[model samples]
Every structure is written in C-alpha cells, then in structure tokens.
Target: MDKEITIYDIAKGVGFSPTTVSRALNDHPAVNKKTKQRIYDIAAQMGYRSNLFASNLRRQHTNTIGVIVPILNSNFQSSVMAGMEKVANEAGYNLIISQSLGTMEKEIANAKTMYNSRVDGLLVSLSHDSESIEHFEPFFKKGIPVIFYDRVAEHKQSTSIVIDNVQAAYKATTHLIEQGCRNIVHITGNLKINVYTDRLKGFKYALVDNDLPYKKASVIATDLTEEAGIKAAEQILKMDPRPDGIFVANDFCAVNCMKALKQAGIAIPDDIAVVGFNNDPITRVVEPNLTTIDYPGYEMGEVAARNLTNYLDALSDVNITNTVTLRSDLIVRESSLKKKLKK
Candidate 1:
C-alpha cells in the first residue's frame, strides 16, 4: 500500500509550519496569496489531502450541501443537479447527493442521512409519495436552510423555486385545442404534489375556457414513468371514442406513450396529437418531434443554490417570500400540430 501524505509531510517538505500549511490549504483570507500558492504547490507535490471532516468540525461548517432527488438517471433531474454543482463548486461548497427512488420511505432515509452527516444546507425535490415533511424538522430547528425545487412542498417560510405548472399545462392544453383537439386526455403524475395538482387544474381550466366539458375520465393520473405511459396508451386505445389529443406531464413518458401508440397501429399527429413537458433531449430525438413545455431544470438549480448561499452568507433574505417562480415556454412541434395540408 502506498503511504498517505499529510499536512505534516507538506510542512516538512516546504519548511513551513503545519499551522500555516493548514490555514493556506483552507484558503484562509488572512493567508497572503503568495504564501497560499506556495503552500498549495508544496501540498500538491507531496500528494497531501486535507482532512475535510476534521477541518469542517474545527470551522463549525461542513461547506457541504445535501441534495435529494427522486432519481439520478433522469435527464431533467440530472440537469438540475449539474447546475447546482456548478454554482456550489464555484462557491467552494461540496454537494452530497442522494436519490429517493420516488418513495417516501427512501426520501425519509435520505433526509435522516443528510441530517446526520451535518450538511450545511439541503435542497430537495420531494418523492412521489412524500406526504409529510416531518423528516426535515431537524434542519429547520438547526436554522439550516432547506429549499425545494420542481416537485416542491408547501412550507410557511421555506423558499421554493419553480415555474407555474398550472399556466404551463394550460398553455399546452390550449395549444392542443387551437390545433383542433377537443376531446383531449391529460396524462400526469401523482397529484399529491403541487406540480401535478396545479397542472391538473390548468388542464381543467383550459377545457372550461373552450367550453369543453371537464370529465373525470379525461384526466389520467399516474406515476408519470415510462411504464405509466404505456399503461395510459393502453387505456386510451380502449376508450370508446379515442382521445383526439394527449397532454403528458413529462417528455420521457410522452415518448414512451408515442412508441406504445405506434405499436397499437395508431398514427401520431394524425390519430392523436400529443404534448409533453420538461422539453428533454428525447423530445427532439423522438420521431415527429414532440411539442413540450421548456422547464429550465439547470437554471432552477443554479438559482436555488445561489439563493441559499446568499442566505447562508447573510447577504440576502428569503423569509419575506415563500415562492420564486421561473419562466417556462411552450415549444410547438409536429407531434401536436394536427392540421393536415394537401400534399
């Protein structure tokens, strides 16, 4: 086994005190830039790594932020995390990320782990079944900021950054109607969270605006996964009068449904036009490019992390506001354009 290097080894090699090496490695502003550079160079030459836990304990700060998401493999969530890491890294903060697997049990366990790890702050997009947020009480008691993004929860004082899901869904539905789809089906996620519930409301409002009757059967609430998409497609196919249009909550799911519908011999844009959300890369890759709502996952993450950092540094306040809504755009494509022209 190779021998591990320490601050002592760097100090000995550079002829500087271990205290100076430690302070320099920590980027203490009091340490002159020249001294800090020399210490860093020596440390690199000696292959020395600072003991992060020991340093954090001494400084009374972990310099680490915890992030919990439903899944890490998701394109949307990954983009959000990428944005968060970029901002947090630039601010000299480390990110400790975990997945909830879309379950409340896993989310609770992750919250506990983050709490026990002594994370300086937390950012969470709640799980599909996360009804109660009691697990986050410890962070609140400790004055550690907890911000929610995307799949958010309603807290009296905590900050949440998200786009207006209701309006986005309304736009998607209204677009379908404009393209000549009256009997539209709305496929969405579990309505326990605000994102899905608000979108459902928007879908209803769009129908009501055009004087189309809002029927309970028109709304198909599910987990919004690929499997759920297949199931929705199956259900739509079996309907007495098949839906003229479909508005899905996620692009991935929408793409999956498109595949399933095609397998069932249903022609997309001709038989049933579709619109999806999140504007994921798959939307463009799918045949007959999908119309979607551009949910700025990366931007949301950057803004959330920056705001939390500002609050932690006492440079900004979040208590005065409860929610910060970002802008979302509707991107039209062949998938939702139902008008047929003479060829």
Candidate 2:
C-alpha cells in the first residue's frame, strides 16, 4: 500500500511551518487567503487528508451529527434524510446515520453508539417500540443537544419536530365522511407510537363530529407493512357489514390494501373508499389514484437539521422552542372522491 500523506509532508514540500500549514488547512482567519490556497494545492497534490480524529480531539467536537431513524426504505424517510444531509453539509457538519429497524433494542444500541462517538448533536425519529428516552440521558448530561422529529417523544429539555398528525387524520376521515362513508375503518400502526396514536385520536374525533358511532372493532392495529395491509383487507372483507371507507396510516400499506380489495372484486370509491397518509409517489401511480395527506418529510428534516445546527452554533436555544409542528394537508383523489364534483 502507498504511504498516507500527512500535514508534515505538505509543510516540508511547501516550505511552511507545520503550525502555519495546519492553520491554512483549517482555514484559520490568521492565515492569508494566498497561503491557504497554496497549502490546499500542495496537500491535494501530495494526497494529504486532514485527520478528523486528531482535529476533533483538539477542538473537542466531532463536527458530526448522529441521526437515528426507524426505517430507510420508504420514500418519506429517504426524502427526510436527503433534506437533513443538504443542510448539515452546507453547515460544515457531517452526518452519521443509523436505522433502528423499528425495534427498541436496536434504537438503544444506536443511541449508545452515537453517544460514544461524541456527536456534536443528535437527530432521532423514535422507533415503533421505544418505551422511554432514558437511553439519551448521557447526551443530556453532557449538554449535547438532541432533537426528535416525526415519531418524537416528550422530553422537557429537548425539542420535537412533528406535523399535526391528529389534524391531518381528522381531515382524511372527514373527507371520507363527506363522500358518504359512514362505516369507516382505520388501519394503523402500533398505537404505542405517538404518530399512530394521534392519528387514531383524529379518526375517532372525526367520527364523533360526524355523529357516527366509533366502533373499537373498526380500528385495526398492525405493523403498517404491505403484508399487514393485505391481512387488514381480508379482515375488512369479513366484517358483518363491510366498511365503506379505510384510512391507513401509511401510503405503502394503503396501496397494498387497495390492491387486495381490488383483487377481492371490490370497487374503490364506489363500494369502499381509501385514504392514506404521506403523499408518496406510489399514491399517484396507483390505479384511480390515492387520496392522501401531504406529510412534509423533507421540510421536517430540513427544519430539524437547521434547529440542531443553530443550537450547536450558539445561534438558538433549544429550551426556548419546545415543539416545531410543520404544515400538512389533504390531497383528495379518485380513491376517496365518491361524491360528484360540481362544475
């Protein structure tokens, strides 16, 4: 293997002191622009890479933010991550991302790893089963800022970024009601998570507002997977009086459920209407299009990242801002539009 180039080698080759070379490499204000450019040129030519480990030791900051998310395969999560990366990179900070795979144990392990890595800040979207935020006590003790987004928790000292899940869900359910769906079923993920629970609340509230009976049997709790959606459709088919509407907590699951219902000879928006959360691309591609809530994952990610970096740069205080709720709205489509639109 070739020898790794060092700042010392760049200093020797450029005829500058190691201190001067180091300052120039770091873009220290004391170093003139010409000196910095010359040092950069020599370092690039010599294949010299700045040692982040050593630099972090000197500065007592990793300049890296750790992000823990539930899953990575979904479009919503991918968009969020993209937004986070753009802001973090522009702010001269790197991101260390990990997935919990929707388990508390994995989430705890990821939190421990982030703590040990000494990340300057942390951004987390809690797992489906994370019962407590005790794992983050180390970061709290060290005064390292932690911001939670999406599936967030209640931490008096930390900030949470979320959408009004209850309100979004209310709008979806109310739209179904307006379309003449009285027997509505809500397919949701585990109610243990705030997102699912809040959505459930909205579903019930909409039922009450419409003077419809809220049936506990109508609320089906699943893992919100495609397979679960199929199973939910099967269950819906077997109901004594078939549900006229379904409000799924996720787009992927809702699309699968729609497919399942179609295969079972059920007509969408005619026999049973469907609505989903997260305006994923699949919603548009699906047959008859899907009615969904536009959960702004990308904007949420940008806001979360900006909030963390602002605190790190001493431009804002997390304590002053408890929760940042982003805007969300309903996008009505063929799947939920049973009533004729008046021209």
Candidate 3:
C-alpha cells in the first residue's frame, strides 16, 4: 500500500514549517497567497490528501453541514437538495444529509446524529409531526447555527428560509374564483405543519374577501400523498354540490386528483378547474397543463446554504435576520382557466 502523505511531508518538500503548510492547505488568511499556491502545488505533486478529520478536530469545526428534510424522494425536496449540494461543494464544505420520513421520532434521531457528528452547522426542513423545536437545543447550547427552510418552525435562536405560502395560496384560490369557481375545494397536508396551515388561512381569506362562504367541509386535510389525492377526488364527487375547482397544496397530489377526476368522467376546467403549488413537472405533462405556483425550491436551498456558510465563516450574523422569504408566482395554464379565450 502507498504511504499516506501528510503536511509534514509537504513542509519538508517545500522547505517550510509544518504549521505553515497546514495553514496554507486550510486557506487561512494569515498565509500569503504566493506561499499558499506553492504549498498547494507541492502537496499535489506529493499526493498529500488532507486529513479532514484531524484538521476538523483541531479547529473544533467539521467543515461539514448537516441537512435534515422530511423526505428525499419528492421532486421539490430533490431540487432543494441539489441546490444545497451545489452551494456546499463550491464552498468546500461537505454535507451530511438525512431524512426523517415525516416523523418526529426520526427527526429527533437525525438531530442527535448530526450533533454527535460535530457538524459546523445544520439546515432543516421540519417533518410533518415535528411540533416542537426542542430537538435542536443541543445545537443551540453549543452555539452551532441552524437554518430552517420550506416546512419550517419558529425558533428565536435560528434563521428560517421560506416562500410566502399565504400569498401564494391566496393567489391560487383567487384565480380559481375568478375563473367562475364558486365552490372550490382545498386539498392539503396536516394542518399542524406551518405550510399547510398558512395556506389554509390564505384559502379562507380569499373566500371571505370574495363574499363566498368558507365551508369547513371544503377544506380537506390529508397526507398530501398520491393516494390521498384519489381519495379527495372521491370525497369531492360525493359532496351535495360538487366542487367546481380544487386548490391542492402539492403538485403531485393535485395531478393525481386531476387524473382520478378525469377517470370519473369529469372534464377538467370545463367541469372542475385545478390549481396546485410547487409547479412540479407533472403539472406540465398532465392533460390541460395544470396551473400551479412556481415555487423557488432550488433558489431557496441555495439561499439557505449560502446564509449558513456565511454565518459559519463569521462573515455575517444570521440571527439579525429572523426570516428570509423568497419570491413565488402563479403560472396560468389550461387546467384552471375556466374563462374562454376570445378568438
């Protein structure tokens, strides 16, 4: 086996002190640019790969950020993770990502793992059953930064990144109403989650503003799964006066609901218009091109990661900014356009 190269080897080869070699490799500002470059050149020639574990231990920093999300399979979450990976890689930071499977117990377990790993910082999107922020206390007590994105919760010591769910949901519901939908149904996830609850508030506000009655039955809270969408469609069909439109919180669920409705002899838009959030690709492929909110998942991830890294580097303080809200816009499509276009 080839012998592992160390900073001492590079120092000897470059005729410099081992400390200087270490500083140069770590890109410390104290190291002169020219000397750092020379050290890197020599280190490469010597096959001197960094001992990140030992380096991190000495600095009390892992050079690693931990990411905890509800799930990893969804298109929106995947896009967010991709964005995070891009930013982390460019910044020379590694990421340890974990999924909670939408359960609080798993989320707590993931948090414990991250704490034990000695990550420099953490980025989290709360799980469906995550009711308390106490799971992150260890990070807080240790002064480690924690940033929340998407499905987030309020924590006095942490920063949160999110899109305007209330405004987006309002716009979606309002659009449906403008398209001649009087009795529109809202399909969403658990109300305990801030995203779903905020959207529900927006949906109700839109109804109240338009002088329409907010029927409790019109709001269907489900797991926002594909199967839930089909069940929601079935329930809607059984209503005394069928819903003329649907505003589903997730594009996946909305698309599935639309498919089920179509199978039940319903003509989309003409019979029941639909609007969804996240603007997943399925929205475009579905017949009638489902109208949706273009959620900035990737952008949100990038911003969250950049902010956390900046804080970790002591470049800025994230606590001053409690919340960072990104932009979201509705994309009009045939799925929810009930008004006929003028020829």
TM-score of each: 0.81, 0.82, 0.82
Off by over 4 Å in 2: 1-59, 317-321, 341-343
What digit string (tens of lDDT, one per residue) describes model 3 on residues 1-343?
Answer: 8998988888899999999998777655578999999998888788775643333443478799999999999999999999999999988899999999999988987887677667899999999988898989978877788999998988788889999899999999999999999999999999999999999999999999999999899999999899999999999999978889999999999999999999999999989999999999899999989999999889998999999988888788535349999999999999998897321
Top lDDT prediction, candidate number: 2
| Candidate 1 lDDT, 1-343, residue by residue in tens | 8887887888889888888877777655557999989887777667664543233353367889999999999899999999999999988889999999999988887887676667888999999889899989977876788999998887765789999999999999999999889799999888888898999999999999999999999888888888999999999999878899999998989999999999999988988999999999999999889999999999999998998887777778546247889999999998988785212
Query: Per lDDT, what order, best first?
Result: 2, 3, 1
Candidate 1 clash pair list? none
Error of 3 at 239 (Å): 1.0
> Candidates' lDDT values, in order?
0.87, 0.90, 0.90
How much lDDT does candidate 1 score? Answer: 0.87
lDDT of 2 by residue, 1-343 (tens): 9987877898899999999997777555578999989998888788775642233453378899999999998899999999999999999999999999999988887887676667999999999889999999978877788999999998877899999999999999999999999999999999999999999999999999999999999999999899999999999999989999999999999999999999999999899999999999999999979999999989998999999998898887536349999999999999988886322
* Candidate 2 backbone clash number: 0
